[model samples]
Target: MPRDPLSRLQWLVFALVSAVFTTVYIPQPVLPVLRQTFGVGEGTASLTVSAVVLGIALANLPFGALADRMAIRPILLTGGLVVAAAGVVSALAPTLPLLVGARFVQGLFVPALTTCLAAYLAKVMPAERLNVVMGSYVSATVVGGLSGRLLGGFVFPPGHWRWAFLVAAALLLAATLAAYVGLPVEDHEKARQAEGVRFRDVLFRHDLFRIYCVSAGGFFVFSSVFNYMPFYLHGAPFHWSTRAVTLLYLSYIVGVVAGPLAGRLSNRIGNGAAMVVGSLVFGAGLAVTLIPQGWAMALALALVCAGFFTIHASAAGALNRKLSTGRGRANAFYTLFYYLGGTAGITLSGHAYHLAGWHGVVALAAGVLLVPLSTGLVEMRLAQRDGSATRSSVARAR
Candidate 1:
């Protein structure tokens, strides 16, 4: 890999990741159209979305473990193309079940690309810069998700919704090619052997276990907020029109900026410090929703988006940095826990909203934030203690 190509590779990976995320969420905005077209009920139509989620949740760890022993660039390239192919098939499927299966296949392969890219980026980037770079990656994902949703609106009015999938696949294919051309090949093979690999190697660390928990916990709250807030906006004093409620998703634009900001802050102050700050920001956002005004709530949503991405970007860097080996597996675990938390958060928070309404949802989200904040403080202190001990050892040697 030449220096210039390598320099561009990070951005290429970011684009590749963004494309993957866009493909994953394309079905979300068009679910109603799918139901009408396929003549299926709501649950059956929604199976297209659920099937993909199920595939990613189940495949993260195994694909991550596989990345360690194999060539990541090829895996990423293959995954990207496979997802595109899935999109084409999904677009043309005659039956709902087949479309759901195609979406499932799309989910199955995407984790390969994401998990491997995280480990590969950790390997190649300067340690000090990795946090910011990872943040940029997270930001790309936000842009991708937002673009896919917006695409549904843009294409569904005149063109059929399937055009959205087709167009997204075309763009994703281009991204995959750029990544394939720009991504460097690994050359460390002659010396190192893969014979001693074991599952315990990646799963047994207490520090990592805590970080994984933090990853899952953070996403749980974030996802809960995003998934359920629409219900609140549609009801009550605000009583926003459906189109106005949809416009509220524009707040997610904050996430596109949040990732890089989180990265730079983490670079200056350390991942723990940045993450704690982000937690406070997010907690504040959640609290601000207590205000009765709609404009205030909108600002609150922006803060929450920024704060969550900031913390999430930091967590990714922390997970990658904690492991000298088995980085892939650690990332896999982090992603696995992340979605698990999201699943649990949406379900539990829905129940909370059901029983107690908006206030109950807020209370549950706030309570959940405390655990990660405490963990961040502990992690920061441990790093400081380690730094001081290293300095003392150096002084004694002198």
Candidate 2:
């Protein structure tokens, strides 16, 4: 709505991103309902969500590499259509296996909408604006994620879960069309310029590896907490209705704020320090979830979203800042780690919830939190060393 001519284009990007994420998450809030309707165990019902994540993780690298080599328009059009088709199949799927498989197909092409687009933006946007824009990009994801949960659980209700998939497909198709028409065409010159930064180079670099680990660990905790939440609340002391549980996702709004705020905080204090503070806030949120009251849990979830997105935005900004080329591959690696962590988190948390309820799940996630916390510390030390070296060089020149 601002006077920036770029604002309209940014909204289109936000819309497409939101649609893809909405498709990815439409099955989440109804996980308990899925278990009943499909006659499956908790673990199997979760496959609806994790299957998509696994697909995304497996396909990210190829999509990432492709983004660098080709224009995103063709990739976006093809991937969007395929994902939308798969989503329709999911709505009509008779059996659970077919449904999960269809969801996996949707997952496979999601990176085209998300990762490739991120790489494209990095390639095209001005350097000074990249941080703020990427932060807004993360905020768009918050909108999409929240929309999916509400549509799955609230608008359609758990009984009509399949309709949620259909609605999501329609939305995605519309957004994809808008994106295809609205986004600027990538010229051959830019495509050729994108070359360099081999796969191994991105995979092996210590700096990038640490950032990847931060992404993995952060999502590992985030996914574990959210994916299993319905089961936890449905049973035991808090037998909330599906609608009540779905409303809890409104807490995700905090992430919309956190993304931009984190970007500014990172710019002011440095990414390393911002990461450390975010990690601490996230760990505290996880701990607070142990309280039994509804208000307590709600507040805790806000903290969780804010903290997680802060770390997420900071890590993304840092990664892009480091890349001069091969951004698609680099961001792809980031998504690969991000979703793989989510997949593992869902799987492991299933076992944990089976053994000791929500407590066990939280315990396992808290342990994984160490990865990001330690990574932040190492980053802080590295940043300090680099700054000292720079100062010394400046002194010598003077």
Best by TM-score: 2
Give lDDT tens digits, candidate 2, residues 1-398.
45574786678788899899999999889999989998999999999999999999999988887887788888999999999999999999999999999999999999989888887777777878765666557767899999999999999968999999999999999999988987777675776555666888888999999999999999999999899988988887889889999999999999888887998999998888888888889989988888988987898899899889989988988898888876667777888999999999999999999999999999999899888888878878988999999999999999
Write out the backbone clash pairs for model 1: none
The C-alpha lDDT values of all candidates are 0.76, 0.88
Report the error of model 1 at residue 58, Å: 1.6
Distance from true position, residue 357, model 2, in Å? 1.0
Model 2 stretches with alpha carbons more than 4 Å out:
1-5, 123-136, 192-194, 391-398
**TM of each candidate vs. truth:** 0.80, 0.94
